[model samples]
Target: MTLYGLKTCDTCRKALKSLDKVEFRDIRSDGIPPDVLKSAYAALGDELVNRRSTTWRGLSHDARAADPLTLLAEHPTLMKRPLITDGTRFFLGWGKDVQADLMR
Candidate 1:
């Protein structure tokens, strides 16, 4: 199982702490390698970018209107943190519901 997220993310930390065999990969520290980013977009399409994030919201209207690929290439933080993925399964955020799904 592999987890893609930032170490500073509390939810990511919590999820990691709950697991004993996770192959943790800090996307922020390691940086979202182009291949992984490409796969993320391939797996979820444009939805990979989360407009609800504060990072996205902080963008100006013009910036917010930018294309997803452009946004992802320029500002990946807008794509939600703690994007935990267990190869086949992918979780967008940290919460009991998501945790339950991932833990399964």
Candidate 2:
């Protein structure tokens, strides 16, 4: 399984700590290669971009409206944190609810 997010991200850290059973791969440090990021997009759709994030807030309205692929290609930070994937299922963001499911 792969976990795509910054190690410093609170949600990512919490998810990791909460679910000790799973091994995770931090995409921020490993630097998700372009191909992988593209595949993730394909899997998760544009929802991968966290519209509520500070990074998203910094982008212009035009940028937000632009294609997510273009935005992600240019600014990978636009992606939501804790992008967890278990080869088939893709999850964006982290929360207690997800933790419960993941832990189970």
Output the number of the TM-score-best candidate: 2
Model 2: per-residue Cα lDDT over 1-100, one tens digit each: 6677777778788877766556676655565667777778898786887788787899888888998877876776778878776767767777676666
Give the C-alpha miss distance for residue 9 in model 2, angstroms: 1.0
Runs in model 2 with CA error above 4 Å? 21-24
TM-score of candidate 2 on Cα atoms, chains taken together: 0.74
Model 1 quality (TM-score): 0.73
Task: Note the residue pairs that clash in candidate 2.
Answer: none
How many pairs of residues collide in each model? Answer: 0, 0
- lDDT per residue for candidate 1 within 64-103, as digits (tens), equals 8887767876786777766766666567767788777867
Q: Which ten residues in a row have the lowest lDDT in candidate 1?
A: 26-35
